[model samples]
Target chain A: MADTEKKKVIKPIKNFSMEEYISSGHRACQGCAEVLAVRHVLKAIGPDMIMAMATGCMEIISSPYPLTSWNIPWIHVAFENAAAVASGVESGLKALRRKGRIPNKDVTIVAMGGDGGTTDIGFQALSGMIERGHKVIYVCVDNEAYMNTGIQRSSSTPIGATTTTSPTGKLEPEGKSTWKKDMVAIAAAHGIPYTATACPTFFTDLQKKIQKAKEVNGPSYIHILSVCPTGWRVPPNKAIEYGQLAVDTGVFPLYEVENGAWKLNRKPKELKPVSDYFKGQGRYRHLDERFTQQIQDKVTERWNKLVELCSEKPEK
Target chain B: MTKPMEQISWQEIEAGGVITEPGNASCYHTGTWRSQKPKYDENACIRCWRCYVMCPDAVISPDLEKNIFVWNYDYCKGCGICAYECPAKAIVMEED
Candidate 1:
């Protein structure tokens, strides 16, 4: 029975590689969730893949003209074309393999962009690529703002947070008044092969979604709520902690939409108050008691909605 | 016969998907390109193995012909550790 349990534990992080593709010496801010997501994805995807980066924080730092910190074959494309570029690379690789030019071995094409690219500018290309049904994985490093461009609010920005454009003051309860855009449901609506939401604090879950996206034959999307320490006005080291708090508070539920089924990976055994998730960040520091409860109510409602979707009686 | 675990597959815990088998997918040219390369000094003649040691992917080589470290720029991330660690001020970081 003990051996059986050991085998069970091995399944989740099964394909996690020991290799490092996102190499050290990157210029991302201390405790940037985007960097953590990239690090984990690289370890999961391994060396058999080629990546295309967008004109976000990753592209600007990893490859600025001649300089690059990428250990794998990478192409730095325009701001909004990471997904489209990846789709092109996927088709090119398929053609090259058919003609015996490139190796026919499984070559995963992953495109990574920030929330600005993903939810705002790159959404059409991203949706088009997914609808086109190419074998690729597009990850949106949803920091909720354009961190590389001084933290401007994007559609992915949460309802109660401050950004450069959405500073907390007398008029605004929290910086951002709009509810966060649901990128996962949007991607799921595309009817793609797989869509998952992950947080960098949970390395095991992050890697699995990456592996699933790579294993599947068609387009896969993962919207990772990568925390931005600088943008969120938190200390550098608390990035991972904030990620855990987001999930624990049900502000960001950990779940996956695989094949056609939605599965909640981690249910909060005891839900933490949404205030803890809010209090640490300067963005939501302006929220009063009533606004805090309002945010909590919204989170609870969203969490219940997720539970309902994941509650499909598991096909008898 | 043993059956797969019944609890929602921990595979879902990570989205654990398997592709290249362990050990087989190990880097092919690892510790190879760095096997030997030429190291040039704009200043001194000290030869330390910092470049030889700090390579995480381990793809550096000592060029026996040029008697210095020649970088395998194809695989290098331009980390510049070698340039910083060169005791002799020998290794220079150049754009490729």
Candidate 2:
């Protein structure tokens, strides 16, 4: 036994709670990083909380006709009203505490939505929630399209990515003509206390942001880039690797905004070319050299702007 | 195990369609969907916990007492993420 123990070397691991808020047996696709992000987020939030989830892939996969994978209090609302429902839930909890019906304790309220539910349908409600200064954490799990609805394109879909609605046909070489919506910028525009972008490939960073969001007094928003193997047409095993590539390529720079101050999480010495990231996925398979160059130019421009923002100190 | 979907009746439905039991979906085994399964080599494992942390199905659990990881194949959809992410290459995806 001693010799066997010596043979196996275990590396030191960061402290992560083993308690699972999202259980197994979920019907999510084999390599669904969206659910993985949810698991890590919930773990960071701990058990004392309520989740208001919009109708999307996560909602459908976790809950079927008569069963659910959620271990904590979770409510499913309409696609456009997850933020609205979350604010309502927060108010109700406050009311109960004031009335002494429930013990006065901090119960974190979190609202979750997909790219389509958040950037398109639920944009107004999200804006209202942030503007109202509700003590809620709104998370947008972006898989780049309306994945639950047969891979339809949404405003959050990246340029040159093919979706059911944004097809690369004889007339249109590029799939989506427009760039992906900058959701973190929109959330920061509301002057929320905290806003950050995270990916499941960096679990520790994702959890750290969630912890920060939970501790903040006012509204906070976290936009997570969930790599979808099914929609993106990548092998299941490559989901996490693709997420890492996304960050390395500077296509999605992981950064945070706190009280109008910007801070970048991971800054690579030199960004990998956009082609290195795009070539692995089937969505960008039809991209010609010109389109890839266009994407590279846009990504570099955005990354430079983010670097500039992070370097500047917030004016008092 | 949960009752089959065909056998469940309207009378058994919970109020407001709320599932009374949390995490009751565990009864529905998803292992059937997997065409391949992971074979773990305990001796080769370094126990870095990478596979445990990245498993989407929550089927990988670290046995703290033994200081090793265990896989619950019942619910593992066998996406091969664990095998692919393993730094030591201790896990291999094999035909189910």
Candidate 3:
């Protein structure tokens, strides 16, 4: 134990906690973006939190029998009610804390659900939570379908996309014909303190947005584009790739709305073609040359609007 | 181009932060457990630990004698209550 004998510098890295909250065993389909995003969000939120999960892929996979992948306090009440359960948890805790019967403000209640839960069935409850100004965070892990319910179509399911309910065939050129509902804008219009969209593949950006949401006083909503390899009919390893494609192809814009201002995160220095993003997946298989071009045009229009919004922000 | 999951360093999936001579970073891999990192602004911190106490993982530590709350992220779930609860806007979240 002598000095100067080449003290191997174990280069100091970013110090994170040693405690493992989301324990190892869970059966999320490989390349499941929801799982990846949830893990990052939990890590960012820290352990002193209770989460209300909706009836989705997350709940079924994490909680089966006595075996639970979640190391922290987590709950799965029902489908389309993740926000409701979270709102109940926040208000219930407030009452208990005020009575000095339980831990005072020691817990942060959060709701995590899929696009189907937050945008369709649970939309009313979600709106109520935001409008009421509950001190909670709601994260919509939008895989774009009801994965737990066997890949059914949800309101947020993109146009010309395929789902179990909307499978393409000779009769149908594409699957779903409806456009994706704008849930983030819906959240923003509720006048919540914070609203933003994140992709699971970009963990750093997702983490930063979560931090921003935490600082808001009333309620915060994070709409995450969590890719679904099983639903998307792509290879297990391609989950994050889909997320990247979504942002790069302008299908999903990476932006944050703070105090009614939009801030775009990444701008493609050399934008990739939308078809490069679409052709990789099986869902878009039935779309003909004509339809694909139309879809691309729509995406471009939306992206331009986003850029305008970003530019509208009045300086620092 | 496709290698076994075991062969690939989980760190490549995510290294919280790293130092490498060859421009390689230590991935704070989410391959194993979900991670959360805390950022602090000491200048604005009143040392009031709404975050330290609210952290479900209890990863943050403060020398009560000194009143400075430091984040220990290994156990942190990245829930962001510390950043949210902090009245002074002190605690921030760093992606791992």
The numbered model that scores best in lDDT is: 2
- Identify the superior model by DockQ, candidate 1 or candidate 2: 2
Q: How far does residue A86 in candidate 2 sit from its true spot (Å)?
A: 0.5
lDDT of 2 by residue, A1-316 (tens): 8976775655455668889999998999997899999999999999999999999999999999798999999999999999999999999888999899998898999999999999999999999999999999999999999998799999999999999999999888899899889999999998999999999999999999999999999999999999999999999999999999999999999999999999999999999999999987999999999999998998999999999999999998
The RMSD of every model to the true structure, in order and in angstroms, is 15.4, 1.6, 14.1
Q: What is the DockQ for all candidates, taken in turn?
A: 0.02, 0.71, 0.02
**Candidate 3 colliding pairs, count:** 33
lDDT by residue for model 1 (A1-316), tens: 6764333221212344645676544455544567767877888888888888788887775543223457787777788898999999999888888999866688788998888888999989999999999999998888888888888988989887888898877887567899999999999988888999998778788888898898898999999988877788886546767888999999999999987799999997888999889877887888889988998888898898889999986454
Model 3, position A84: C-alpha lDDT score: 81
* Candidate 3 lDDT by residue in tens digits, A1-316: 3442223222222423334555434556544557767777887788889889887788776655334567677777777778888988889888888999996656767898888778888889888888888888999999888888778999999999988899887777678987899988888888777899998667678888988888778799999998787788876545666788889988998888888887889888756778988877887878888889888888888889889989995567
Point out where model 3 deviates above 4 Å: A1-18, A314-316, B1-96
User: Clashing residue pairs in candidate 2, if any?
Assistant: none
Q: What is the TM-score of each candidate against the true structure?
A: 0.73, 0.97, 0.73
How would you encode candidate 2's per-residue C-alpha lDDT over B1-96 as one tens digit per residue? Answer: 567555679999888988888898888889889999999998789878899899999999877667678889889999999999999999999999
